[model samples]
Target: MTHPAVADLIARSNRLGADARNTNYAGGNTSAKATDTDPVTGQDVELLWVKGSGGDLGTLKEAGLAVLRLDRVRALTDVYPGVDREDEMVAAFDYCLHGKGGAAPSIDTAMHGLVDAPHVDHLHPDSGIALATAAEGEALTAECFGDRVVWVPWRRPGFQLGLDIAEIKEQHPQAIGCVLGGHGITAWGDTSEECENNSLEIIRTAEEFIAARTAGEHPFGPVRPGFAALPETERRARAAHLAPVIRGLASTDAPQVGHFTDADVVLDFTAREKLPALAELGTSCPDHFLRTKVKPMVVDLPADAPVEDVVTRLRELHETYRADYAAYYERHATADSPAMRGADPAIVLVPGVGMFSFGKNKQTARVAAEFYINAINVMRGAEAISTYAPIDESEKFRIEYWALEEAKLQRMPKPKALATRVGLVTGGASGIGKAIAERLAAEGACVVVADLNLDAAQEVADGLGGPDVAVAVRADVTDEDDVAALVDAAALAFGGVDLVVNNAGLSISKPLLETTTKDWDLQHDVMARGSFLVAREAARVMVAQDMGGNVVYISSKNSLFAGPNNLAYGSAKADQAHQVRLLAAELGANGIRVNGINPDAVVRGSGIFAGGWGAQRAATYGVPESELGAFYAQRTLLKKEVLPEHVAAAVVALTGPDLTQTTGLHIPVDSGVAAAFLR
Candidate 1:
């Protein structure tokens, strides 16, 4: 059973968190005071239910709430330490738990517990933060709300800050909320509805204040000449080209997944002249700063610059960024400080192309980009009213390296086998390609599902969990330009291509005398040339990334078996098989492994079998079309069927860590087809 007050609190939190205008992801906490019968005491006690640490309020559930005895929480004042030791209080919160096995309490718990109200909300709404981070934020706060929302001085979030806000609230009995300098805002009320409305009032008022002050002023000054966003085709073309290079630079320390967005907010900001100056000052809100890092690297080159020139400049800029980051770490770090993480910029802004953000995985990368956009909004608002002044760099370093933040990072689950790897699978919409996409995604590799059928590819990508895990790309592997763009899309969607599955193929069966040039060319172009094209483009990305990669070709047993009336398909398969060995030998020096999977017969869920080839093969073997699979299975020594999943398993094995030292080898997924064995 749920308490009505807690239910109302959860509902309130969802409403606030759901709107990006109100709060960023997991950037706020809400709480309600409720009376519950303590199991042991059999008497009513006040329980405080607050959104727990790391839980996003938008998707919050009862399980995600930290329930604490309000009395016990308030009793903490007896053992309260000074501001210098406030970090220790976070651990102390564990003792105030209402019972065992609930979401762990968060740092903001103190803020909610100490406030003398049944409902409390602490949020980092961009609008509220815009006023909070302004140079004259206190004056602006008074001017905006006329004491309805008072101003609190800058104080890092902790037990002492909670006490500070409480005292201010007590002194100003009529105040409903207050804006924290260089931080965000807090609001409270006697009821959930009152609290929710108060929070909105503060947010909306701050926004209107900034808007009235600027009154349609250009946020980033006039756009520089030729710096506005490029045409849709050109912007994306540039993004695809530059994404791999940026991803490689961002992965200097550890492999990272990348996300590229040309959202109007990013383009509008990056296209303006103030981009460099504002980006250098970095983000204001702690959540925004934490995800996007201290600052972003702004590419000063024109978006229309020569591809080579852009690439060259990005490399140079990345090197400088790394050195500067290292220096920043050295200047602020103390003996007790955590070791420097990485010197790579999490966010990169290209003029016209938009923003590129990176993280150890896809969701993190995407959220980082979103956070920067929020930061940009905050900057625009703050600049409209007054100077945009965020916390000092030293403060950012403290928050970034805080012991509490480090602990949270340490608690994250271990990455799956293909953790930061990105895989591009041709023919990914159906058959073995679809199975391969699902399996690879399950193992933690972000997937690019490419196929000629755009709709089917999208279905598979959606089933694999949307853009966070998989994205669909329509491509013709036989076309060089399409193959190149497909590989680039993988880089743009993720960080780079770490695993390449050349599974797009077709088959044709005909007697040597009856086979036309059309049949031979079609089979060879799709099977042999397509494999070569996809592998070559993937290899280029892998080489630039400097990360060793794996390439698996889904060849066929027909490559080695001499079957009657199978000349064209057999020859194309042979060409694909040989290409695998050749690529293995060439790409080996670059740490790129090439391998092949040879399946004897995978009739079920096979695109080739579904497309007239199955009937032709059945007729050739004098078997009914319905029993074609059984007939092919019977000829194998093991007398078992080889399925699409079987071939998919082989693909996973080839790219998995177990086969790191094994390449240029074709693993047979056939049921003991002795005739198709590698000679």
Candidate 2:
């Protein structure tokens, strides 16, 4: 006979699921265990009634509950060969249900059975998930709960996970519930009301913690209000794609996880070029790890991107995720080690778009989805506190390759593009400029090489290998007309300019007292004034184009410190440093990004050193040309002379999509010069 509380429990479980569905496509799941002893048998029997598959909790019925005997499931562990046979597992599970062969048990029956409590309810609440994404998520949880919770690192769900939990219960008999890493939470008690209360408390605690932490901080800062919301059709499509995953991971009688779009925040953060750092923050909890992974795949969609394109892009990300997972595994795996299984994420968060979570049931999926939202907040918070530093590549590999960790990878769709769009360079002629120009072109952006030397620019353009791939332009950046011409040339050639590098400058050696006005003017003309000119012209084009742009100014260590006899060059470069900040503010309204690159003494044979400065400067320093190079090299933290190529890479980073919203930033390409200043 059915227990009296079973019906009430199912109703409450369905309500929780509905709540989840309305909130974030969370795929939340709930279950109620029958605690009443059989009057005739006079024996205790565990019966868990979990939500059925493919049903939404908001509109659930009695038929949705798949009833199963908990003890029977626990005993079947010894009978199965390895628990990989889903068909057999399903058959055996169906045998113990109330109907005896009607509907299949929820995929998370095993997971629910692991909890010793009579009733267990799990959900991927948005607040709870966000707190779990940090590198110190466990600490965050502790701070939120103060020893009322048990934390489990991410582990693949199903038999292995269930078995592990069962063992944990044996060790810690009084443990209440668990929060799974990269996944979601599990709350249990003797009654459905008790479980629900516990789950609610967890959500409330997490919400309060996040609110306290972000009390006075603005995620996107002061910006325009009343932005257009995402289209309804597009939102539904995204929701549909994520629903299944969320449902699959959840443990409810009906999938009730809600899904909402925070397009404004997502877009603003992405526009700021902070996605990579945000993604590195990982999920809110280990349970989320199974859905979203440690990091979410970021994509910048055009305002006009079609629904089909968005979906296609998502599929592409999944494919890339698989490849990345495989590569990561290969990098750290030992010969005798077990290989990683699955290569898909439990959750996929598209900034400025939406998020997707996958699971065998609604609760798990909702948990994953909620975790994704939490991740965004935590990432934003961590960024505010200090730059978020996720585990390094090696550590990521360790987690991705760990047998337990690998099990979280799921089946996913394909990836979209391998390269970004648009590029710019200041001194794109020889040495570093030429190398950077070539690198970006290879990655597939129509390149514009701006240089004071027209002939050198032409040569670099010629060597770039395609007629439409690169264009050489002449500009005395200090001259407004020339700077305007360079911008116009790039726009005419490639539709519009998206990147600019203020790289044309000369370094001269002269003691402060001995420096003449003529020497200062010459240095200031190209290094300081030229940078402003180029930035102004580029900003105009970028703003008009409406696609945003990047401006990277190549400054030098002389800007940071006074090298003996280099007074004029140093002063001019220092002016360029200040220029980056001014331009950042000026063009910020137009979505134009600006930054500066400061490189220490780079080796000769490059454009910056090509005009006989290498030999002359070397001799004046009282050392041979080759020995002078070594002398400068030995002075750095790395004891390696900064190369033109190193500076070129920095230029690419500043201009690339990888750093879309980053502006007014200064990156020291010196091995450690500025660092020494701090020391």
lDDT of candidate 1 at residue 655, scale 0 to 100: 86
Off by over 4 Å in 1: none
Error of 1 at 581 (Å): 1.3
Task: Tell me the tens digit of each residue's lDDT in model 1 across 1-679.
Answer: 8889978988999999999989999898999998999999899999999999999988899899999999999999999978888899999899999987279998889999998988999999988999999999999999999979999988878899889989988999899999998889999999999999999999999988888887675867888887789998899888887887888899989989999999999999988878889999998778887899999998998867888988899999999999999998998998888888899999999998889999988999999999999999999998898889999999999888888988998999999888889999999999899999999999899999999999999999999999999999999988999998898788778867899998998888899999999999998999999998988889888988877899999988989989999999999999999998999999999999999988987899988899999999999999998999999889998899888888888888888878899889998888998888877
lDDT against true structure, model 1 = 0.91
Query: Which lDDT tens digits does candidate 2 get at residues 1-679?
Result: 5467667776676667666422234255667766555445877766777766544556666676777776787777777667455335545776666535224565567767666777776666665555444557677777677666667666544666666666655566565566665456777777777777777777777667766767574643432332223465554444443332322222122222222334454545544454555564555333335456656555556434665675566556656866776776687778855656555555455543455454432234445556566556546654443334343455445444544333323322221111324455777887767777887776555578888778888888888754356778887777888776676565434434567777777776767788889989998998788888877766655654455567887887777876678888888888998898898888888777888888887775475565766776787688887676688877788788887878877877777558877889888887887442522
**Candidate 1 residue pairs that clash:** none
Worst 10 residues of 1 by lDDT: 213-222
- Which model scores highest in TM-score? 1
Report lDDT (Cα) of residue 286, candidate 1. Answer: 80
Consecutive 10-residue window with the lowest summed lDDT within model 2: 247-256
- Listed in order, each prediction's TM-score against the native is 0.97, 0.42
Best candidate according to lDDT: 1
lDDT of each: 0.91, 0.62
